[model samples]
Target: MPTGTILVADDDAAIRTVLNQALSRAGYTVRLTSNATTLWRWVSSGDGDLVITDVVMPDENIFDVLPRIRKMRPDLPVVVMSAQNTFMTAIRASEKGAYEYLPKPFDLKELTTIVGRAMSEPKGRPASPAEETNEHIPLVGRSPAMQEIYRVLARLMQTDLTVMISGESGTGKELVAKALHDYGKRRNGPFVAINMAAIPRDLIEAELFGHEKGAFTGAQARSSGRFEQADGGTLFLDEIGDMPMEAQTRLLRVLQQGEYTTVGGRTPIKTDVRIIAATNKDLSHLIQQGLFREDLFYRLNVVPIRLPALRERLEDIGDLVRHFFMLAEQEGLPSKQIDQAALERLRRHRWPGNVRELENLIRRLAALYPQDVITTSLIDQELSQPAPSSLNGEDASQNLGDSVERYLNGYFDNFGEALPPPGLYHRILREVEYPLISAALAATRGNQIRAAELLGVNRNTLRKKVKDLDIQVIRSSR
Candidate 1:
């Protein structure tokens, strides 16, 4: 006797044969069919322990039949296979209540394991109505890396799991967050995003948890924070690694108690908002450095999704380029097409700034180039120019000064007519010194001597500063 009767459906005879053989070899009896009609008959008659069906079939659409199958036999698990392999496809499979979704060219062993699990596991809830999507897709690319991300995001859309997205800057972390909110159960709710790095450190709490009138000198009226504003939706905390330690403590409390109070309000407001945080920095490293709270990290990292950098998914560069081109045209830029050679050239270069960098380059090409078609030579010329960071040596310094100026202005603004506390010089210097020294040490591969030289300070002074600041240094081979 076989372990179970498995029904396999695919338009391709070769695929049906492959699945039939694979399942048979795994000690299960397999029934093969090339159309959805036979598969539905088997499912409706309760003749099969499990059903594996392709999305596209000759006579019937699988997605259309899946909900009916679920209605007739709610306990029968249906595994969906698709060659389309887009994010929308994965979402549809999930929304239609697939036991598991396998993209084409999947590993045979993985399918077998899914089959075993699906047969043994208890029955799941019936399929929910599929959510409608607009024309705009927040994420693109069908690369294997992106497919995995899509599968994870699809599963997460129906739940309120707190997700932490870790990736390098400009890797579309915000886009991922927005997608989760737009397609999730909270689709009808608002999505409020706040950049931790953009706000002054002292004001972070007020920005997140709101403030009452007369809470501070700047509070002329009551203000609702991101959390209160997000109410039944999602609160996206961008650059979460840049959050001050004090705010992390407060955030942890909110996550723990599911409620929070404003800056001067005594009444605790219940919070029903979902949290989705993104960070380019390593939270583990920051935790070790005592910069990030470990407890808060655990709270927000319940469902962690690490986005792949552009270099890791070069296969999707062509798709991403075309997407940007379409977006540019929609924005009133001249229609432009990139030749195959130019696209290949783009794939060869290291995209240090990731997708955002590519998007900017595409927009620039569409705006600046006169030709309707872009060539490899033009691509080379655009890429040869120094990156925005390297365009001017003073850019970094100017940005740093501007950030400091903005913070000071906010600080003064908060005080109204009053001056900030005494010892302002030392306080500000210490704040600047820590990151500057840490960055220098990181740049020098933790070589104290090299860091000291780079900072134009004595080695002894650098060592003492490192000790005082508790900056961990792991020296690398010179």
Candidate 2:
């Protein structure tokens, strides 16, 4: 006897035959149809043990008939298959009470496994109504890599699971976080994002958990932190690996107990926020180096999602370039079009800064080049120029003092009213001293007297400073 009867619907005869053969070989009776009308007739009459339907049918859309099927047969399970594999499609399938969603060209073995699981599992509750929105697509790309990400994100939207996104800088970690929050059940709630790397080490806790009026010397008034602001929503902790060890401990406690206290308050406040943390660093390495807490790493890495770099998904470069071009035109930049050769050139690049770097290059091309068409030579010319962060030889164009001042300005901007860590002068000087002495030594070919003269310091003082900074000396030929 057959294990169960499976209802299969699709407009394509080839797909129907394939699924029919696969299901029949697996010891199940399969009923095949090409239109939604026939599929719904069988479903309404409770003729099949399970329903497998395509998103688009010749007679009607499966999504349009899905709610009626659910209302008529709440116990029946439906697996949705789609050729239009997008984030929105996956989300809609899930929202319409799909047992599972399979993108086109899926493996036969995986389909069988999913079918088995769906048949054995108990029936689920009817899906909640989907939220309405008219925002632009947050993520773009139809490569296999992006399709897999969309599937995972779709499954995660209904729950409050803590997601840990790991990727290189500029690979759109925060964008993924925002997509999750924007499409999730908490869409009505606010999304609070804080970059641990941007904030000072000592102030990280206060920034996350708020502070009492008299929390510390500089606390003139009570303040609410990110957790309070994100209550009933998502709290996105970007650059989570940069969080100090002390703050990590407190964050772990909050994750464990679902509550937190102000910096100087004794009363614990309950939290109803979903935690989504992201990092560009290797937390495992940090844990091994004693810079991060292992317990905290485990707490944050509940559902880890690693985003692929641009080079890994080079097939999507053309789409991304077009998207960026559209954005640039919307922002009042000159309209520009890239030729095939120019796009191929982009695909060949390593894209060390990933998507953000590509967007900036497109913007630069639109602004600098007056021509409507962007060619290979123009792309090559723009790419050959040194990146903003690239440091040239010893005599780099940017002055050391000016660079330090700019870094301090950014650091101070991270904290609005709070002061930076104590011993600012010593800390800043110590940071600058090592590099200054090292460069001077390298320039003078490790000669103590000449290096001292170049730095306008005494030879003995240079030796003492080198010893204190642990500089390794290499003497060149005389």
Candidate 3:
């Protein structure tokens, strides 16, 4: 066994000496740097198991230097140290890719443990998700957000740790989980899924753990459950938030012990399946409500991925629509064309149901719209009468002219064969600009200063537009 190598970058000689001795004592090789330039050099071409660098290194600020360093060593786990820690600085550092941020004067034991964990972490290209047997349900989007998701999924593929996916309903949480299993190192193995909420309270355990013949009234012959079926690959538990409390205890024990007997069998059957659980509800809150187990929560949450909602990443809608359309066309449906107007209309609508809803809408358009044009007018009609039962009255339909104008205004609306008249352009632009400005402002927590920076305009300019367009800003937890 080779010892781990740690790169220590700090301006203070005392701190460097202390870390070096501490790491050396813990059976690690220590490489030292006194400035950001040397730190950058080591990071550029050198390989180290871990990096511990001071935020206020001489020659350059860590924040300004990190972007380039990240480009060189993208998977490198970095721990940032700072004597002057502020919430903003801490957030910025973590957001940039620093694995952990520690305040100055950290304890030796803490340093040793954190460094050890970082070194042992899985690194390199994550396994590609399992190739779809049927490409009809492909995940789409080339937006920066989707690209980020791809990067994360790729990294996760390198490790077989349990993963917990959190997203609102209709955000395709299951799709993300499936992607993890498909591209991961376990792709060749079976992938089994079950809904914890869908099963009756008395049956979740039986659904997970196989039952021997005569285990219970209906247990004729032996039965294998999801865990057994996915023993060599992945087992996905959806709606985990709704899992029964008693079943949660059993599941937690199985995760910790890695072996479980069938419902009525005496001998234990070991499984090597990777567990991927998802939920639309907030599990943390459930834990507080005493309906979930803390130990179980921590075990399954070894890796957490937060999926962004469709409304949160509207820029990707254009690509998703096209992907869904391609899928529909492959199914023998006539290909549908969406002009810039229809695309914009889709983007501006608050997608409460997220990408899944968008996919359904696109498929409906492909299947039913009379003409290949798929005009904005058709979209308006569909929006007004859409899955009334499914949406359950969350639909807030805009007036007819405004809806038509919103779609016709965007540049990409040209894709549809029948374009809206030029006269509607100015009004629609104002409508689009007003809502966008309001949304950004709302996302910034009503901070006029931050909102202007995000909108790429002067504060005074944003203020004038807010008044001119009658933008109503709301407070959001941005």
Estimate the lDDT of model 3: 0.73
Give per-residue CA lDDT, model 1, range 395-473, as digits (tens).
Answer: 7889767767875786567457756445567656765676688788778876677778988998869867875554445
lDDT of each: 0.84, 0.83, 0.73
Residue-level lDDT tens digits of model 2 in 43-145: 9888998898899998898988888887888778889999887777888887777778888977889998888887877776556454544347788777789
How accurate locally is residue 61 in candidate 2, as Cα lDDT from 0 to 100? 89
260 Cα displacement, candidate 2 (Å): 1.3
Tens digit per residue, CA lDDT, model 3, 1-478: 3388888999999999999998998889999999988877777877687789998877887877776666677778878787653333444455456776666666678778888887787886221222223223345654446545654664566479899998887788878888777656787898887866444557778889979899999888998888889988999988888788988988988999998878888898888999999888888898999989989999999988888899888988887888888887887777778899989988878988688678778866765444677778878876876231211122432344454556445433544565432334454465357556766776676666688898789876886776454343433344
| TM-score top scorer | 1
In terms of lDDT, the poorest run of 10 residues in model 1 is 385-394
Candidate 1: residue pairs that collide: none
TM-score of each: 0.81, 0.80, 0.56
Which residue runs does candidate 3 get wrong by more than 4 Å? 1-138, 386-478
**Model 2: CA > 4 A from native:** 125-128, 133-135, 389-478
> Candidate 1 regions off by >4 Å?
124-126, 388-478
N/CA/C clash count, model 1: 0
- Local lDDT at 433 for model 3: 72
Pairing residues by index, what is the TM-score of model 3? Answer: 0.56
